[model samples]
Target: MTGISYRRPSSYSRLIGVGGARGDRIVPNGDLAEALERDDEWIRRRTGIITRRHASREVLVQHLAEQAARAALDASGVPAGEMDVIIVSTVTWMKMTPGLAPLLGARVGASPSAAAYDVNAGCAGFCYAIAQADAMIRSGLARHALVVGAEKLVDFTDPTERTISFILGDGAGAVVLGPSDTPGVGPTVWGSDGRKGDAIRTTHDWLEYKYADDFRDVPWPTAEQDGPTIFRWATSVAPHFAAQAIEAAGLTPADIDVFIPHQANLRIVETMAHTLGLREDAVIARDVIDTGNTSGASVPLAMERLLREGTVHGGQTALLFGFGAGLCYASQVVELPDAVGGDGEYHADAPTAMSESEEIGAGE
Candidate 1:
């Protein structure tokens, strides 16, 4: 048999646009004070979060993802029909079947033939999805791709759980990537430590609830984490990998114009920046102060905030890093895009919404 042929790869992939969407409800530390039995100051001292957004019970993961994706598409001035691929990174979609990507693509009016799927790398998901999209584009498998990170952590959080309840939030962020004449997206440096997998995970597995001796008495699965463990791992690993990512791009920390780490905590962000020896002029993202830890959506959301506020401008070089859950982490360097959208506004008229009781299957 003749050998299979392949399409020529593109020279590079670059971000064309960025967007974000936050939940409708703003939840302050004071709101969670009674449950966590801690004062607002204590919460702020620990996580650097004064407030966070929580989607109304009526809102679903797909709604946040679709809204963010549409904003990115609109900002890029690229109709959804031109998209060749769509990747959604989320852990709170609830349903296992009928992956959210296809639905999001359809909602955004992407071409029927576009390849779409979901990614579950926890907090590092968005970066992972970006790496994947960059690869696909470089290999000529896609001409334009949409990468989104969305989460509704409220659905998986227990208000009384002091370790995580005060830290979680809901939101989504997205970016559009297309071919570039020069290197715009840099090499990705990523890895995971599964030995610490239990450091951040749901309290119960689906099988445990399904096979429970008393179904009604079974606790619904909610997220929990070993705060100290995650904090320690993230702080130590971030600096190393961030440097590797920068080096992989043939640059040094001084060359970076901005720093956007996972908005996990303010202390972690500061610690990593210092240890990495970044220039004093590098603008560091502190979106966590108001957005809390948005899991996979953190990086893009923070990036969007910086761009929208004029703190960082287009063509600036940024170092992006994300670490959490799976103990997984990913880092890369990229040239910032000019188009930015989504101003933390919640549109009630958004098309996608689902009730809390809905039980949809994966890939349905």
Candidate 2:
């Protein structure tokens, strides 16, 4: 917090690179049929999720974030020591302190003086972090910032829960934002309806469990949501944000090149697309079909997928939005960043700017 200057700079902030890392274990719809009492077709029809990935016990949330940060850093050609800020967005961090940002900054070899911290805006976290990074760069607080969104929702998932078992997944995604000569990130449009907070949240209260005479009587907390509530809210409100983002960027819906909303559900994606009246040529991300709802990680993960597949290219304008638990939401229009291989896949021999020894404890 030492960099206190808040005056607006003459230049703008642009995303230079982006990368994503998914869990190793793939869980298909068949894997959840018994637990949810639902078959593959049913799951696909309802949530449009055919499969998802669950992080193994040995893979910590920090590991996924580090991998993503490395990819983004490598793609950007930005040295770790040059990082002025590192912001990690997540709600699934296991530790109560030393938040994921610092741990990720260490793993990614970020500067010791870099401002590092975490944000927990639920599934909307990535959008929130992006907005913050944009402000920091434009306001002269930082020149280069690494923004990451990672989640290990599997740690809190209840296997037998019908609404959540088939929806949640694990993954991390990252982007490098730096000072640019022109505006690449537009003004953000965000708001939260805390009145609807209970529509999605943990099943048990941590504070209540801690003070209980018999903790065993309290069930371990797991995620739960009012499905109908979210579906209705998202479909109705997301299009408004999308339109606002496009306008804020001085563009029209037809001018938008890509649409990357949070990959929460395929149905939601399609519904929002219809509402936006997106151009036939505009690419809409459907990464959720494979990655599932990774909460805070979904937006960036989806963005990486679109870029990797060459569906969207660097310099193209993309409309990004995120909404989830706490009824929080954020939307922005940003120019796409360069991807590894001209796509988003990382090359094995690409210099990551970090020595091999420094990459230790990545998955440990």
Candidate 3:
């Protein structure tokens, strides 16, 4: 090993800004009901999702990521040239090599020598990226970093698979980190159970299809999930991790101003909230009702929404938890940024206003 070593100072990194972007197409439950023969009420009762955004054939994951990154760069007032590190959390990238970070860095005009890469930890990806970014900053390897969680889950979805079809959506969210005198992000609590990896998954290995006689004829592997298994894991086990994150942050649950768990389901969020025993005035993100489950993008998307919508203000402490696929889980507490976008509103045309029929019929 090279003998070069460095020690971190007492200072910590802070999330200085935030931003989020969703696809143009809005898909409501009515559209899914027509195809699956399930009523809108049934879906709402089951998953608390009334609508979600699905990108058109023209929209790629890169497009959504870049939009959010630009907004974040503007919000932070930190030029892309000043960033020394970039990390993207994703699992829905179509292109496996070259990674999403380099492309995002190029789009945002990051420094030529910046360390950029992508990480895959399913829906827990955002939290994992945050944890790694915090460590890098604390270790003095990076001074400022941009962490993004983005997904194009629709590409892996089959509308006929009613369970996952109505739940998955497309979107991206981002945050900028910078050095601070005090801790802006707390210690992270993370763990995984690989044995339960089959609970939620997609099979897209090239090796499995490399020898196929006709690759075009192959049916793309769609996403699948054991809903009950995941629900039990999230509701029963995630609360413990959430508490650990709070403790690691040198705070108590009662001190938290907001609780932003992964936008997976309303029931899970409620259960976690109750288990944590947070103050009654605490804000909890319920973006899943409209944004659906954006997987890796859920946490940051919810965070940006909370900030942009004025539900939670800057400097308040918030607890963020992300868990799913690979049975992976991660949680941390952070101080909210003062602003979400360079402008007051990040997405001026957010949620894409659409007529009832057009919005619901987007799936067609």
Off by over 4 Å in 2: 1-10, 341-364
Model 2 / residue 349 / CA error / Å: 14
**Alpha carbon lDDT of each predicted model:** 0.90, 0.86, 0.86
As a TM-score, model 1 comes out at: 0.95
> Model 1 over residues 28-108: C-alpha lDDT tens digits?
999999988899999989988999988887667788888888888888888999999999999988777888898888888
230-302: candidate 2 lDDT, tens digit per residue: 9999999768987898898888899888999998899999999889988998999999998899999999989
Model 3 CA deviation exceeding 4 Å by range? 1-10, 203-205, 342-364
Considering TM-score, where higher is better, how would the candidates rank from best to worst? 1, 2, 3
Model 1 stretches with alpha carbons more than 4 Å out: 1-3, 350-364
Per-candidate TM-scores read 0.95, 0.92, 0.91
RMSD per candidate (Å) reads: 2.7, 3.9, 5.4
